[model samples]
Target: MRYKGFVIFTLFLFNIITIKPKAIDEKDSLYIDNCKRDLLVLMMAYSDEIRDIEVSEDNYIYLVLNNNKKIIYDDKKEKNKNAKILDADIQDTLEDIYPLDSINSVLEGMDPGRGRSYTFLNSIYGGNQNEIEKNLDFFSTYCGNIMFNKKAKAGEALKNALNEAKELADKDNRVNNYIFPISGSYNYRVIQDTGRLSPHAYGIAIDLNRNDSDYWKWVDKSKGSKRIEEYPKELVKVFENNGFIWGGKWEHFDILHFEYRPEIILKSKFFGDTSKSNNKKWYEGAPLNDEIENIINIINSKL
Candidate 1:
């Protein structure tokens, strides 16, 4: 009986020793997990351009932008005639509110390595790789300090926009279609030893269908000027509803690019398919308007 008691006591001590380290490991893992979630929220709230997010074992997150392939912008395109000049008043307002030095700091900080990135102007204006780099560098220096400080409102707005976009996409039978992920803070990128802050750094940008996209840079220079005619209106509407601006709206035209620049989109009055004044209407009509309404209804019925 004495020997049995001693064995039992020794076994209990061993179990406690083993369980303590396991508990500590579990606690450490949970701490790391929570830290990552907080950082992700911060990044998503800051920029809308990030797509394809991956979290690694080491706690680093990898993100890539859905930048469209570069293509030529044809001057003779019908849309060019309709392209409204960006509001001068808004431009002036932005200039006054976000000075050149501030823009520069944001750009400089975005670069992961060297401080230069390519920026091609409208194809009609003639392509100059060197000139694009210079302009981007200058712009970065000018607007570097314009930090997006409105967190709670921005997050709420973004979530609302995402839900609206998802509903619209479902209605249009494009539910499986890639919706741009817009939320996240901007980060600097260093590629090929050149540094330039991608618009994605702002967390309000998204790109879709990288495989089927056209970009100005991908256009054959020999063609002189050729504009890609395809534009993803359904996708654009989703973005616009969420207060994002499409790259297709720009003369340089990146059809797949969407950025969170509510100030510009709102000023342009390009609300896409989402009505600003009828937000409540949108919410009520969402399930009805989409093809997935039946599925959603069935799920609700079960509940």
Candidate 2:
């Protein structure tokens, strides 16, 4: 009996010692599992334009375009040096990151859309003012003639979303109050106080209902009123569902702004579709996820 017990223990110990953690496969090595869905969708959906994507030994992500333009993403916000996703900050499931049901829902400074990969954007959209300018097209909405990136699919996305909102307004006139009389889009310039170009420069952002909009910079710092709940949640939701990120969610909130950033909506929905119990950090892969691919499929079909 003692010998049998000893053999059983030995076998258990041997099994434990021999077991290995799953190796990070080539796919996972090139693209962290968390980011693979978003990246793959981007590549396959734009396969004609995008050639390949690779990861460096140090884990920097590179997007190689058909035009041979290479864009690298190396921003590591969380996990200190251990961040696994390029631009992991914004590429996260944002609604999960800042739960709208929470007491103070506006997680200021935690702007998930602010992690802009300038090189990646310029490569995908146009590189310079001259290149960007030629692609611009003006679409007339009830709001006004909004100029935007027609070739990049941004103009059409905005137009479709606004048209849907207009349809909703026809049913309930209140929706019209949120969108119009107009604010500007397609401004060819850099952002004030920064060298970076605004999404407006790419003609991919719009300002709406400027009178009701609250800008953080315009506010006196001593007033402590940066967190106003003015932008209609319904209007915000409509824009967000259509691939736009609201500036009202930023610490440096600009209540009137909405910029087209489909990836954010994709990542947010990916998280929203997964297990709620696994509230791990963004880098950690979700345990059981099959929907992001389907979501991407639907998005691809639309595109």
Candidate 3:
């Protein structure tokens, strides 16, 4: 695998320099440049094995690998839900962003605008469903039994985080209601209303106590007043600290949903937005080398 990456990267290096940068508004240009650098920096933080990165004339950021495969940094497509991260109104820090205050006062988490990038995530887990399925493992928690991607090593991280949250719930009655029996994880499917793939498809997202949870879709969309009165904020802190982002934070409000997105957490801490990730060391969960290699292979195949 390493040899494949080296060969592909060597062949592609010369090709990238020939592709001129796109012409856009000065402000947009600066944003795109920052996005490009951040995307490369973030990939490197996770694994230094990434061969190369380049911004195209169309503003797509490509992460090139040795096997000649590539993953789009952020497609920035009208249809790409995750591409919204480049333009979403996100906060600077986890605390400030998830602020358990009145929903009306907060706008940062309202629209995660960013949806999960399938190719990018596939790189991290496995490129296809069969590959990803091989990495699936089950864990039992106070909430219930759940399945998740063991390759990402986040499943273990979440189990640990849940232990801490369980301790907190034991001490506080209110916290007990936050996580009832879990709904699910690792379902291979596109989002219900869109062609976009879901984080659940990668086995990184979990939906908690469906009965207690409130989804925006359950209510009238035009009314526009959805208030969260029962989500345990302390429990949320535990998940975020472990690299999970709560759906409760989004304006769409899927109170029971939480997905692993360490990049977003790290981005909030350093740049206050998920736009830039330069110079940050990966100090989050322990990522296995084999898994990282699988991710690289996916990137190369796509490139």
lDDT of each: 0.36, 0.62, 0.60
Pull out the clashing pairs in model 2.
Answer: 109-251
Model 3 lDDT-worst window of ten:
86-95
Q: Please list the residue runs of candidate 2 whose C-alpha ends up more than 4 Å from where it truly belongs after superposition.
A: 1-31, 44-48, 56-59, 75-105, 220-228, 273-303
Q: Candidate 3: how large is its RMSD?
A: 13.4
For each candidate, give its TM-score against the true structure.
Answer: 0.35, 0.69, 0.65
Candidate 3 segments whose C-alpha is farther than 4 A from its true place = 1-29, 48-60, 65-68, 76-110, 140-145, 220-227, 273-303
Residue-wise lDDT of candidate 2 within 213-286, one digit each (tens)?
Answer: 36767764222233344445667777877878787776556667888877566555545444343444432342
In model 1, state the lDDT of residue 71: 26
Better of 2 and 3 by lDDT: 2
TM-score head-to-head 2 vs 3, winner? 2
What would you estimate as the lDDT of candidate 2?
0.62
Local lDDT at 172 for model 3: 96
Candidate 3 lDDT over 1-303, as tens digits, reads 999999999879856665433334545645544453344335633453356666578756676655556766654434333445432221111223333233432244445524445556667677778988888888776666678888546688678778988898889977766576667788998777877677788898888767423666775432323335445667778887787777766766677788887666644544454333443333222234765555444444433
Candidate 1: where is the Cα deviation over 4 Å? 1-152, 178-187, 190-195, 220-230, 270-303
